[model samples]
Target: MSTPKTTVHYVEDKINSWQTRSPFIILFLASLVGVATGLIGSLFQIGIAHIISWRMGIADSEFSNIYIKCLVIFLITAAMGAFSYYLVKKYAPESGGSGIPEVEGALLDLRPVRWKRVLPVKFFGGLTALGSGMVLGREGPTVQMGSSLGKMLADTTKIKNKESQHTLIATGAGAGITTAFNAPLGGILFVIEEMRGEFSYTKSSIKAVFVGCISACIVYQLIIGSSPILNIGTYISVPLNSIWIYIFLGIFVGVIGALSNFLILSTRKFLDLFYQKKEYFFVLTGALLAGFFGLLTIFLPDITGGGFLIIPNVIDELYSFYPLLILFSLRLIATVICFGSGAPGGIFSPTIALGAILGVLFGICARTIFPEYDIHLGTCAILGMAGLFAASIRAPLTGIVIVIEMTSSYILILPLILTCVTATFIAQTLGSTSLYSEILNNTLDKLGIQRK
Candidate 1:
């Protein structure tokens, strides 16, 4: 009996030793990935800004006329789009979607992590597509590239443990969002909310994600100077009576969000049918779209890029409701076509913008119908943001966190909660799943890609 007791105690000691060692090692390795993700993310942002400024400088110089500037922009964007299309079509076709979905899939061993191909392709390809003034956001590409970088480090260091590999992947992703918006809490929330299906949320993983987010934010602040992406001014708190209005706004956004997703899926299917495995068709289509958008950049700059610059203007009433509506509709269509065409762009920012527009319209209507409430249109704008995004993506928590982080208006959390929850419920009741997951599944179906 004494010998048996001694053996059991020895086994217990070994288990405890392993448990203690694992956390320490994971934390240390996760920190390394965090620093790399932060540095790479910061550099990527700076690089894109520099590219855009340089092109604009050349356009402003005596060497380039109006026609010459147009020509240069067209060629640059066309070539960029063509190259980006080639990479997505040939190397990692699964990378065509928002990349968030791919990360989710990867966690479940449902997708491969081609770090070597994806990291470079998404980095430079995203730079080209974004810098060319395509209506794309850098956030999606950054997340994909950040995750790839994590995979690269794991492979290079001969990380044999599956848990270790997955931990780094999530860590990098958190860092990516952190760097993208200079919002650490948002980064953590994104992983927890959007990637819930894939992320293995453990005590250590949560802590690691937090660490990565903070580190990435520090790097981004150092480079970008710590400012909110949008300066919509301070917002008045939403009264309890006015909260129901946000719910109604959420329902309206839900309808629109459902329609937006339907269109995107339909457009994707049409492109698949038309292209019919012809890579050139894909590349040429991208080039043509890029050229057209580049032209818009020169003529009507409001209709281009991720639409961040347009939000504050709209909120400030810089554009009349009618014009804003028209612009909103046009951008909606452009966003669908551009994203559906798989042009290395993201619909995230555009979706938020669309929601803002809808909210503004709703607010104006509410004010006219019931002027005694002293309603603020900007609050509706914020609510609409969470609502549309929640309705479209079916991730209300993520939408809420993202909007709050982007605008730095955490005071409206209650309204945001009401809007996002209402929108998500309505959208689901009306039959729409998460947007990114749907797109990822569609892409996988087209490619005949599968995971056991």
Candidate 2:
């Protein structure tokens, strides 16, 4: 028989051993989340591509009646949008809109993660919304769904620790971003910067994020190939003297980014007046918006979709200044409408496209004013991509790293840092809140959850 002191010591040792091993368990789970997110995200991308290609192929097929072809396309896209909206309304309202805010809320324990509903709802709904040519991104759905998967694993595996749950959720979110953009470091930085407040940042948690990001990237590359998302030709180093122009561009993007945020939030609020938490009204609004975009996509393809296709054209100067300006204006409006209407998509790619447009416009004018510098317009476009993201998201590091990784333009780091930092500083100075934070606050308010 053991003495009382020996029994107590034995129990202490057992507890200590479990405590030491628990982190490894959590890390292993995080890696699993990463692999799952990567495969799902890749499949999501493939599905969207097939849908888009099928739609375009049909549109281009030799048909006797052109008007009928157009009509058929519009009807098909509109139906897709309607179906996606219906799913969100009936099955998972929380899956509507960019799911990033929801993940952030979940991390803070301010929201619940119903993965069974969210996974299916976000996956299919996002496919429909994106395929319908809405100015939305896949990243939002991927991140939300990934985080939901993490939560599902935790619950199923009986991970009772709150901190562990938070870490896994964040890991999945980071991995989702990695899979979406093929930027592992950017994904890791996203968790650190964008989700800073909610992310635990413990040694084990950070390592888990790393593992998840790497795993997600590996899986994504195996499926999607290792090419950068944007294949804009390599840009030469920006001249040192032209750094001032980037600063000015940064300031410009800061104002525009602030304006963009205001428009997005304002539009969402206005739309909410009609929705009033009525599922039918919300779904109807989304469908109507989708229908409109479907028609627009058939006509002005430049301003529709998630904005990736437009970036290369913009960087290549395919459109002159006037047309670029017009495209930018239209896309700004489309982005606000699609995102504010609560489509199951993200504003991230749209925002980056806007920045590229704005940067192109600025570059055009700059070249006209200063012919001596012979500035590379592509550089400006690149800077704008990071600048606007930095200002709007208030996550400059992630923005910079993302731009660098996406473009493979590490030589432009100095200019990127200058522009992104300036944009973020100006946006903050102008009293603009980070986009995700604003969205999260709005969500919590709607749910009547008070912040601690």
Cα lDDT of model 2 by residue, 1-452, tens digit: 99999999999888779869666678789889999999999999999999888877776778788788777877888788889988998999899888998999998888889999999999999999999888999999999988998999999999898999999899989998998889999999999999998887788899999999998999999999999999898978887776787889999999999899999999888988878767488777766777777777667889889898888889888999888888999999999999998899988899889998999999999899988896888899999999999999899999999888888988999999999999998998898999989989998898799965
Off by over 4 Å in 2: 1-22, 277-279
Give the winner by lDDT.
Answer: 2
- TM-score for each prediction? 0.92, 0.95
Location of the lowest summed lDDT over 10 successive residues in candidate 1: 55-64
Question: What lDDT would each prediction earn against the true structure?
Answer: 0.81, 0.89
Per model, state how many residue pairs clash: 0, 0
Candidate 1 C-alpha lDDT tens digits along 185-229? 878888898888878888988888887778778877877778887
RMSD of each: 4.2, 3.2
Index of the highest-TM-score prediction: 2
